[model samples]
Target: MVFNRKHIENLILVTVLTTFSGQIYLSPTGGTFRLSMAVAVLTVALIHFRKLPVMLVCGTVAVTIPLFRSVVDYFSVLDADFGDIFRSYLPVVSFYISYGFLFLLLSIREKLSHPLSFILSLWLCDSFSNILEFSLRQLISPANIVSDVLIQIILMGLARSVLTYFLYNTTLYYIERYDRSYQENRYREMIMFISSLKSELFFLQKSIVDIENTMKDSYDLYRHLESGPQKEQVLSIAKNIHEIKKDYYRVASGLEKVLSAEEDRSSLSSREIFDLIRENYQKLSTNRQLHIHFEFHCRTPFVTAEYYPLISVLNNLIINAVEAIQQYGRIVVEGRLEGSIYRFSVTDNGQGIRPEDLELLFIPGYSTKYDTVTGRMSTGIGLCHAQEIVENHFGGNIHAESDPELGRTTFCVMIPFDRLQEVFIP
Candidate 1:
């Protein structure tokens, strides 16, 4: 709209393109008067880029087309000079210049919303401009006019007007479709992003609950040792726990505020949840194991409001499977609804859990992972946290089965449909 350097460059492009369209013309009865797709090209250009000066484009085309054709014509005849026979194409110059101004005077661009009015106005401009060309040609050559030629000219204008309208509509249709696809993909990404944030909020709330319980136990200890030598130490421990509880409360409050806007999002689909999970761990897998591949399946459509704990539980199991594998492995996650319960299983072809340690898998501070480089023990609470969320939040059960002979471990979780999906069932 500013008529900057970009607009000047675009104007030059429209000028060259319109002149090229005019060059591809056909003479009806072996005369200099020509019919071409120049009008259609011009109309489309004006419709698409409203900031391009319409008059400047059309007037420039009028000069460039004849000048280019005259030079070509002059070269065709070796005896002709620069000025010879260029006047014969003068009618075309009048034709396009008149077409440009008549287009503006008729308000063709503004009436486009009314299809019939726009086409009628367009037909008027093209037909009248051609008629002016024919009259000028008659004055220059003293030729006779036929009635059939006039009708053909008018119908050609109508045909080109209708064609231009379709061209514009088809272009608009594709643009709308592309915009719709882009918006749907962005919406999916947003839902997954909110799901991750909600998972973190669930952990913060659980930490606050644990801190509160610990503070109560510490105070009870101080009361029991009221007259003992360690009585003040017990009270000091209670006070320190009290301060930690307040910090946890501040963190929980901040996380709650961040999730406030997304609270209205009632549920999420099972397949979408798994897709997000697959995308997350697959990236982590590629960094450690080049040949690690993942596959996920959902037998029935499921939607649940308990997706925060759900994501946390699945992320723990999959990460455990990923870390258990040394270099190359396959991890498959499958979910299904059976009767009144939903079940999910994560199977991995990794180093299997030991037979004697199977019963100890859910115990807090119990793990088999040891980091040789750092000489440190794994925090060993991942499976315990996962179990707590499953059993406490969703009233579910989780367990593992090992086929040590074949080196595989599968952890399965079962939750009631009524508990996980009462708010949104799908």
Candidate 2:
């Protein structure tokens, strides 16, 4: 047998449990018939707890249970002689020692996964151990060991074995479910954190593309205005834009490095992503104290490598829904994989857009919200940016539908499945 600190600690635990539970027994005062919970406990502990070294623990428990009980018995009845007290309990030692060797011959660990085989092994161990103890008792003082006693022992052993088997499997069933639930929650948290990080990264990257276009257009204007009266002014504007572009480029590059330094955690399950999006939006708007209900209509899981842009697009739509609502509303985010296309819809019960404005929602600098206090229109670029990413990066299209009477709006995005998976750098 092998041993380690952990293995020894387990041995000690098994011994302590066996000794204490062994004390709770149904034994007739002068008869050898005995039934103890300790037998069931020892079988369960040894079988279920794979870390314990079986032979060593069984040997230790065989000695500990009998010795510990005898010492406790001697002290409890101070008037009784320790020798007779120990001798009367002597047959139990043979029972445990024989049971351990018998269990070793059975290769108990391998049978655990097979419930029927496991129960049979336990029954054999318990029945044989009791017979050994009764035989030892007969040796000390002659008594008839009848067939009736044999039948009773076997029946009791079978009862305990069946019960242990049921209890172990039932406990395993619950534990498995708990672990899956814990893992699902953990995945949601991790995706939320990554979504926050990569969403910012996406903004910086998108800005780089805009800065490049601005720089090129400015340089072209400078060349066209050369030798003209406004030559110096246009040249100055081009140089200034170049400097700003350089700064933005450096920042975007640094963020790219920060993301690339870690392992590739690019892809995530769509079910958790959808659930997290719903939960995160709900929590962020809680301070509004509105009777808003957030709902997710998709639980089917798919894998996506374009989570960064995907989340950024959904964030804009959800934020738009929040801003649209005043006091009470419901927001539902739904996703479906249809044929070769992945479709997502964000629907909300808010102040709906007019039919004319629906076509203009994706246009840059177009928004329906007007700030009365400041006498200014909102920045209005959020939907435009989402459309840009969906159309350009994902090869997808986004559109809006509004039912003015019902006061509801739904923004749907549909992308080819292959396009989303192609976005992962690694």
Candidate 3:
């Protein structure tokens, strides 16, 4: 085994239960410990493992400690007869039967997964086994059974069950904290990589713009040339220049998006930020010939945030909404103040998401868009990057909901106002 958390937990339970085996004797006869402690540890182990065969093997190994003690004592006192030896084995047999019965009860009933049910099952099983042992020795009477064996078993089982329940919850708490820290570190690394890429694209975009202007001037000079042998050569050169210009325009357009994403928006208000995004998308809508209505609703005129990331998040969501539509759709971007939180949403009447695919939508390298003929697809990091920025940097939340049949999807982002204030004020 690779020794993951589950394996480590199993090892701890087995070691602890076996070490405490001879510590708390509850019987007058020579049983060396309170069986309830081992039972409680076994119950916790069963909850973790859930597999019956694994639990049975672990329980068997744990019981061997106490059983060995009983065997050594019996042989040391040689005056003991066959009857005495048989009596010495009674507690071990009862302990095994109790754990087996409790396991069977839990396995059969789905509702018995609750701690209360597990504790009740433990009490009943332990009490029954003890009663059987006492009855065989003719030590059980109606009054004595109620006051002595039954009450003691119930109290012991209850204490151990409660202790084990708290321990299990504590273990889960630490595991979650560790996972959250690891994810935050990954987000920081991604942010650094994106910053470096944007810097390179910005310089490249500037150089392409200069080249495009020079090409435009050359074409204008060629148009002015007289009709002659030199004129024909100049015209051919102009044609080639025009084609190269077109290629540069396409490259520059993509670079613009990458450059715009990292713009310093630290000083922009919420309304100003939305207006900038609206202006950019308006051109996109006109170019694509898509009749998409865009609307922005902001209750608060201004809210402070790291402007670039806020812009990037809203831009990605709006673009995703626009691309989802086939020909025509309505996109509504809304912002408001809900107490100490800034809430923003993008709702689009486009091709909606499937229920099963909704959860995977924000995972990196996972996309719903695919072009079968050309074998081309989206990089699938837009939403994932947006989520990392909102949650990790701003301590916020982002989620989406969709109705596939109605072709409507809505993405919502919530950032704490105090969190934004911390970034902008300092």
Indicate which candidate wins on TM-score.
Answer: 1
Q: Against the unseen true structure, what C-alpha lDDT does each candidate score?
A: 0.82, 0.78, 0.66
Q: 37 in model 2: Cα distance from truth in Å?
A: 3.3
Task: Candidate 1: list runs displaced more than 4 Å.
Answer: 1-160, 221-240, 268-297, 307-332, 348-388, 404-408, 423-426
Predicted structure 2, TM vs. truth? 0.59
Candidate 3 Cα errors over 4 Å, as ranges: 1-33, 51-94, 107-118, 129-151, 170-426
lDDT of 2 by residue, 154-240 (tens): 887898889877766777788899999898777666666665566666666778778788878877887887596587777788788
Structural similarity to truth (TM-score) of each candidate = 0.64, 0.59, 0.39
User: Which residue pairs in model 3 clash with each other?
Assistant: none
Order of candidate numbers by lDDT, starting with the best: 1, 2, 3
**In model 2, how large is the Cα lDDT of residue 103?**
79
Lowest-lDDT window of 10 residues in candidate 2? 417-426
Kindly list the per-residue Cα lDDT of model 3 for residues 24-54, writing each as its tens digit: 4466333432443555455555555554354
Q: In angstroms, give how far residue 383 of model 1 lies from its true place.
A: 5.7
Error of 1 at 213 (Å): 2.5
lDDT of 3 at 407: 93
